[model samples]
Target: MPHPNPDAMAFLLSRRSRPAKTLRAPAPDRAALEPILTAAARSPDHGKLEPWRFIVLERGALHRLAGLVEERGPDLGQDADQIAKAASAYRDSPLAVVVVEIQKSSEKIPQIEMTYSAGAVCLALLNAALASGWGANWLSGWASHDRAFVEQGLGLSADERVAGIIHIGTETSAPPERPRPDLDTITEWVTE
Candidate 1:
């Protein structure tokens, strides 16, 4: 026998991501966030290879990362607007959890499967944050793709890449509901 949790199901159906810019303090403290992290860790991994990691960026770290974005912009050939956009993520976020994909060298699990596992972790973290009563958004910008930025800013390994930056904080305003895909148009039922 299985017990059904309708509230959880409903929450998943209605949950929306709050814009990172609109997220304000006070964000979840370590004690409050631990369970959410644990929930996020429950994401599927084909070979039980935890090929993902998280880096929690607190207030000071955000400022430092912002400065790194500004400093690295010229070298990366990023225009002023692009630099500002990259820097703004740190400037605006009250708290951010950087999910990193640590690609494992294994014959059994394909590289793409490892990437997929990392992607699953990102979504899990986002959903966990939302379920924990905090607004959350998963983001990645040009900064995420720049090797220098990843290495210097977050000290990521050569095989590691930024999967997402999960920003969590209080919602300043509710985001308007957007149109969802029509299920019938996307789903198919097959019977033989």
Candidate 2:
């Protein structure tokens, strides 16, 4: 029989992502964050491709990206509000881990699987932060997808794109529990 870990199950059931906007300063330094990143790297990768990587954005780097967004927003035909929202995330965030998805060409392994691996890395990073008693949230906005913005600000290559930006910091306020999807509506019991 498989050994049961009630504590692990209980933690998973209760884990909730704190809103990125609600996160505060005094973010984890490199030494403190290394373990979290290491934990995230353990996410599943089909065919052992390890097709994802992390970019740790510290406070100064975040501000730089914020400036890039401010300059590029107008060029992208983004409204003032849209630009503000895009820049605010970077400017306000104490720390943001950019989960970059790299599309590797392979015959045996599909590109779709690599994309999935990148997505999994994002979630794993968020969960790791939360499990370590830190506020965390996974986010991706228009700025994240814009080629110019990503290339100039984050320096992603042609074959790379942002899967998610996982913000980690101290929680200022406890977010209220939101509605959850009912299993009856979303699940299927196919025993045929």
Candidate 3:
């Protein structure tokens, strides 16, 4: 018989991500966040390449990024409203974890696989934070995708990209449940 973990199964079934903007102060400090990071690092990695890393953005780092958004927004062709929205995320966030996807050179393992692994890590980290009794949301905005923003602000390497930015903190209010996918419409069975 397969092992059963009813609580774990239930948690997975009911897991809901809190909105990033709704996350408040009192985020887990470094010592408290280490375990969550450790959990994220355990995600599956093809070829054992470990093609992902974490950058925990504390208050000061978040402020710096917020400032960068204002200073760099116009250069990137972002208008005032866009800049404000982008900057607010960093400016108001209690804490965030930047998941950096590292592209490793491997013959058998494709680069796409590495990118997938990084994405998996992002989900794992988000789940970990949620499971640890913190509100968490995974996000990637226009600024995150901007090469200059990522390179100059976060100092990502040439071969690296932002897979996700997981904002975690106290929940100001429980988010109302939204519509979920209809599995019947999305799933297809295959047999040979």
lDDT of 2 at 41: 96
Ranking by lDDT: 3, 1, 2
Greater-TM-score candidate between 1 and 3: 3
- Please, what is the TM-score per model? 0.96, 0.98, 0.98
What stretches of model 2 exceed 4 Å from their correct place?
A: none
Error of 3 at 73 (Å): 1.3
Hey, what RMSD does candidate 2 come out at?
Answer: 0.8
Model 2, 1-192: lDDT tens per residue? 899999888988988999999999988989889999999999999889889889999999999999998998998899999999989999999999999999988999999999999998999999999988899999999889899988988889999999999999999999999888898999988998
| Tens digit per residue, CA lDDT, model 1, 4-118 | 9999999989999999999999999999889999998999999998999999999999999999999999998999998999899998899999999999889899989988988
- Which residues of candidate 1, in runs, are more than 4 Å off? none
Please write out the lDDT profile of model 3 over residues 1-192, one tens digit for every residue: 899999889989999999989999999998889999999999999899999999999999999999999998899889999999989999989999999999998999999999999999999999999999999999998999989899999999899999999999999999999999999999999996
Q: What's the alpha carbon RMSD for model 1? A: 1.1
Each candidate's number of clashing pairs is 0, 0, 0
C-alpha RMSD of candidate 3: 0.8
Cα deviation at 31, candidate 3, in Å, is: 1.8
RMSD of each: 1.1, 0.8, 0.8
